[model samples]
Target: MSTHPLIGWAVVHPWPAAGIAAATLAVLGAALWVTVRTARAIAWPPGPVLVAGTGALVCTGFGADTSWRFARDGLGMTDTTERAVLFAAGEIALFACAVMARANKTATSTDDAAGTTGVPGILVWAITGALVVPCYATSGIVGGTIRAFFGPVCAALLWHLAMGLEIRVARPEALSTGLPAVVGRELRERLLSRFGLANRDRTAEQITRDRAVDRAVHLAAVLELHPDGALSGYRRRRLAAAVARSGAGTNGEQRHRLLQQLAARRTSGQLATVPLASPWAGTPVPDEAYPRTPLGVTGAQLRTMDPLAAVRLVRAAHPEDSPAEVAALCTGYGVPVSETQVRIALRAGNQVAAAPAAPRPVLASEPEPVLGAGLRLDVESTALVHPEVQSRVPVLAAAGTRTRQVHARVPADDQTEPQHTAVPDAAHPVPAVPEYAVPHNEDIPESDRDVPDPDPLIEQARTEYGTAVPSYRALKTRYGIGQARAQRIRDALGGTT
Candidate 1:
């Protein structure tokens, strides 16, 4: 029925047809297993090609085995190993085509998602079925049925290859066991650098040792979002690391000092804080929807806002900038704004969502307690309020301290003035006045030596007032005599009048 030995033997011996078919199927299955194993052990397109090529060879071998006899008789193989040589050549060509196709697909896939290596779903089977056409011409039903299985056998080998073409499945990031892996792994030590997993299951000592790196990575992420040079968004740790990286200790004093400066900038208005995007926080808003600037990304909705509304938003965004500064900034941005315009928007407050009001600084003006020896006053207790401290603010003015409000008009509390009853410390017994003007001190008695002649000043005071007993204040005012001299005159007035 058939010319081929194996096919003829199976046909002549009816009982063995099933056995021969099973044996052939078994061989094909072995070849398929090896092919799949090779594919798993290798990389992408090559793995796929190896698996496909091996199947192609195994399927081709069913009709065209590498055996010399088959090469010589049915095929045109001349040399001893020519059959294998030819098959190998075919495999190489197939592999080259597959690689070129994959390369083309990879290039195009970047721009076109649908662009990828494609294998016809029915190709192997179709080819195998076509090859079986010759079998039907040679053999009757029995032979035809046996040889017809060649198509299925070949297609079965290529099943994995065809399936792989449709879906380019990727392996997860997993390291394969090998010498390169052994050499590549960090030999010193490995620490979790991921922010999310940083502290997880870490011991106190490990955390303490690795915190600097963790902080640095965290800072890097923050800068990715906000990206302000001196601002607090994500640069504090980066700036600190720069100091430490330049040979300071991980938590060294120099590093700490740099960090302190950054912290001060954050609190003062020197550095602006902006929104940061973090993995832990989830996917960031799209760049188109959230436009980015030197400060940060603002929502796309800002594009629709009117001029006044936009100014208000800018004011809110950069609260650290004064209204005039913001106005100048807007004008520079070609918005044609002025300081007055910004002020008007701020006062209107309705155009933009306002930020929470910051707490105002209260300067302490509570009177300082005069804690020294002579007198004491506690604001809480209300002991004699220091009238001199309140009224003598001119004292501070003289010393170059300007006081806005000095209660100079408020009369000093009576307790502060000297007691008038102090009859001027009993003056050196008033010596009798010398009779002549400009009298020589030697002409006067020793007891009366230092005494000034009050007769002229006395006559002047007596003429101005009703009597010679001139009051100390009246004598001081009219004669311009000081308090001590006036006291002496007043004492004389009593006896003389």
Candidate 2:
């Protein structure tokens, strides 16, 4: 008897089902191995990957069992084909998720901040879920309805956990509120520079010190905005030109020299602007100024020259000097410099003499030729004592007190007598006149230099008595001179009297 058509159909379906199972195992194993390798490489806080992998494997087994039941129950219907399709699609998505999780974790290790791995981890799970859920829907409307509700919930939880793991590996530290806000702007600038969309104003070392996420985002933005330098980027052409003019070989050397030149120009208001006769002036300076340049002097020739000459020649020879070369020159000279080490020594050889201090103001009453100290209290007294004297002079020290006697002579011959005196003439001398004819000169006229007027003072008092004479109370209280004039009165006195 001929075999039933149903028997043939059943036998062919199991083989395809078995083929899918084998393929699923192969794919899952490769994906699992990738995850394991990534986890091993980081030697991360170990348990999470193992748990996650075990859970995925368990989910895969459930999917396989479901596939078998659908194949057995649906037999030859279109639904049976759909079941196989869902099974294959779901396993593929799970495999993709596994691979993505490992990739994200590996990427996190490279990032400085682990928490920054959030976006990437979520992206992986999202893409896989988006693709995988449709597979269940294709199998049967009921299967689609069930997975639609639950798949998202499970994928979300897994995504979050994967992100947490990635964060721990990438951004071990927490960020402050202000840091996150600034990160976007920082990232934008970096992106523009990386892709040549914007001028790369900052150097490599400067970028290294910057945060990693900001740098990555900057790189990404640059690439996005100007994939082919199409945006007509910013040119730090001014800085580059300045560097060239500074005659410095490297960026660092150029910065140092430029700063020095700017400062010097500001102070002196002059710069070395050589006037060229033509557009292509040969090396700016004269031939004598640069003896070695035309000759193309080697290192040995440089050593043979005078040390100072060598330094000059070195500077003149190259259009620019690198910081390293400048430093090397400084080392050779046994001098140290923090910047611009090869700068020529500018100190003059001779010392300048100091000018004398100007003379101080002097008093009319004080004698000339007095030093400032000697006249401290006198002359226009040292300006130092003027205030003190005006306030009331300080009492003289005991050692400063001194007294002197002055004498006066009274002549015995007051009336005219036979006395004669010879008066000298400028150019000629006459014989002395006889005593009878000569005029009497009274004791050098009894010099009135220190003597007070007697009769004149008495007469002046009669005309201006109230103004001239002290009041009785003032005389008695202050000077102790009462109602009478005495020529010689004994008085007791203190220092400097």
Candidate 3:
């Protein structure tokens, strides 16, 4: 009775067979350990792990057998030692390929999929086929050749599965949002580049202070654009607190200084545009010339007058005053005046009187403009009042109250006859009230009654919700109003949802 070919060969070459068996056992043990360890670490799914393991075992067994036969017969190597050596080398090479694939997968885990350049699966298959076909053709063993062809292909697929499992565990954020990886490796690198040194040197308190300062800088910009009523009370307080934490002085002086610094940095090139002949274009003036005191003109008059005219008038009366002083005076008067404006006026060489002109007398029929604290309100046209200022002044507050009263008195179903228009004479002059001002009921037409006032609702919402006001639809549902009315309320409240 003849033994199997494999058993007969092993008996003939005991040492080589033993060495081959030992190497095979060692490689399989190492592979098993690595697979188990990696699976546990990345929480790999059971199905993929089982499939990969099965494929790896099948491929390794087939590959070792084919490598041994190919070395002995196809390569014409009669020596058993050489054949065993070739077989072991082939197994090592396959293991090395799998290890390389694992490393490559780990390395590129954080790289954006869109940015990465990977070896195409077709190209890998093609290369594997190119190498296997020639060896299979030379060996002339159909079953052995088929095993050789599929062995490396299955091993490649196993490597791919391992890599996929690693990515699934390590970079789930990339897949979850259908976006490139952002959370772990890339974010760590960016944060290290930006804050590593500072974090190392600074204490927790110091780091916190730096963050507060950064927040204050951002809030300062918001306050500049939307001060007072434009911001909800909560937002205003939060912004003010942030500014104060950054050491902005009392009454926002430091905040204003920061604004000036920012403005200067933004417009640093503006000085180049000034003519050489201008007084401000030359050397800096003495500090004494730029007094902080009020200018000769009142705040109302300063705001009403042109910037250049105001500058010229101030300059003529106080020739000693510098452009900075004039600007300070205008600013104090609630009229923001830049030094550039004063310089431009001085450069123009316009003639001016030694004193400002006297106020013109107002006719009884003509309404006197009401000057509020830091605001000018024209009775003839309520539109001129700034929305922020309108929120503060009592006169406009009264208008809102009167509007509500008028709405309440007029019955929704009543259809009164249209009254004839009357021209005002000496006895019945035009009333001091604005033509379209809502709260008063005297001359308002019936047609205009339905036009809703959004101010009251806006104020009510602000009082209720602070900065987190509801959407227009929510407001419509809450207030039992139409979409248009709700939209008007939203618009009045600075268009915030």
Candidate 4:
């Protein structure tokens, strides 16, 4: 049996063989370090590492074996030492190419960082490995060795060039000359189908119609929830783009028509309408539902009023009004009271019968007919005036004239004749009536107040529970409060638990 060229060389040149082995181990360690570092830098998976490592090993082993075999066969050179030297050189060149590729990839900009290379490590190695036998067979020792060294370098460059060309050619859209109309249409349909926007079984006309209907429905929903005025220009453009991408019209005429239809349906009472103050702020209220009325209160003032208080005030003014009508009345007053809140107030009112009607106070006759028209006091005013008015009324009275007597007819059981009290008017001022004398529903329990202060309860909860408070249910149980109040307390506590 003939001794292997490497084994025979090792026997004669033991020191050189040892140095070569050391260099091989050093190259392997370097390759491993580079692979791991590059993989981490680019966030690559272990698959690329395994693939590159296997490629490096296969290329080195195969190229060296092929070089030895070709030289022994006297295809280019019969010198064993030259064959061995060329084999080692080829192995080193292949590894150098791999390291260079990885280093170049790592040095790329952050925007181009990749988890995988454009040309895979395995294919590059295989091409370079296969080139080894041909280079040595075609040329003598000196020329062959040079070719072997440069073959892997050239292979790496060619691989990158091939990848770039493939990418550019693969994009049909990048071609300067357009494709045939039919081919372009087919490509568009294929792309749409891949993205689930088109169906193979459906005709293009049917697809376009379906997409238009979908866009119409989406626009209708958006308008139904948010008025066109509420949508920003960017948001409107985005929505328009979305609609246009679906093959729908871009002018928003369809959206306007949809809004008209939705408004008509809500006006006809076919669809439930939301309050204009809340989720539907900028939406126009239907004329039939919210008739314009001079309610003397602005939307800003109404919004400031407690929702329950607004409901009660509107209900008192229109006792015969339904919950919807009461809500409409408040809406007319510039308040956005939902029908649901009116309904709740009405239900609570039913449980508690209406309070006894107070006697109408007779206004003292003015000496010279006080300037400005007659003061119009809303029916609920005698019961519950807003604090803003309450404070302002006293200040106005203090600035006006002297005291005037106002007679109020009392019940026969209490007094046969009418009772007299000093009252304030525009021309004649008297000491402001005591706040307690106001005929409000004082008989109602303290707990039944429309709005309660949440601060004290929130503070107490924090003191008791520390940083991590229990759920609202636990708070409700401990505080003996309603679910809403407990929730408010928990929310105020930052919802720790």
Give the candidate number with the greatest TM-score: 3
- Predicted model with the maximum lDDT: 3
What's the residue-level lDDT of 221 in candidate 3?
57
Go through the candidates in order and give the C-alpha RMSD of each one to the true structure: 33.0, 28.3, 40.4, 33.7
Of 2 and 4, the candidate ranking higher by TM-score = 2
Cα lDDT listed for each candidate:
0.52, 0.46, 0.59, 0.57
By summed lDDT, which 10 consecutive residues of candidate 2 come out lowest?
A: 488-497
- Give the per-residue lDDT of model 2 (tens digit) for 31-136: 9999999977886554674565455555555445544454455443356567666544544555565456556545545344332333444455565556444536
Q: How many clashes show up in model 1?
A: 0
Task: Spell out the clash pairs found in candidate 3.
Answer: 402-439, 403-439
Model 2 CA lDDT for position 439? 20
Candidate 4 per-residue C-alpha lDDT over 323-350 given as tens digits, one digit per residue, 9 for 90 to 100: 7787877877667778777878777443
Model 1 CA deviation exceeding 4 Å by range: 1-55, 63-129, 138-142, 151-454, 458-481, 484-497
Q: Candidate 4 has which clashing residue pairs, if any? A: none
The TM-scores, one per candidate, come to: 0.24, 0.23, 0.25, 0.22
lDDT of 1 by residue, 1-497 (tens): 53998777778897889887899899999999999999788765546656775675565555443223334544666776666666333224333444454554444443224243445323433444544544454455677566556533553446435434433434223232323334565431343444333456866654544555445545655665577656873377564654455333655754565456446544555335655666687786564423333345244434455667767777767889887787766655446677778888888332465899999999988764454444454223345643211322134536543323211222245256654632333533554442222224333334334545544665555566545466556665666644445656666565331
| True-vs-predicted CA distance for residue 221, candidate 2, Å | 40
Tens digit per residue, CA lDDT, model 3, 1-497: 98999999999999999999999999999999999999789944567666776777677666666667766766787988877666546556555655555555555556444122133333444444544643465456785467656676676567556545555654554432212334665666777768634356777754554555566666655665567755657666776676666565643645565566557655667898965666666767676422332454565675687877877767776788877887776666566778878788889444365897889988678553434433334224333853321323134544533322222222334546667755544542433333343334343434334664434676888787776757755775677654445555665555532
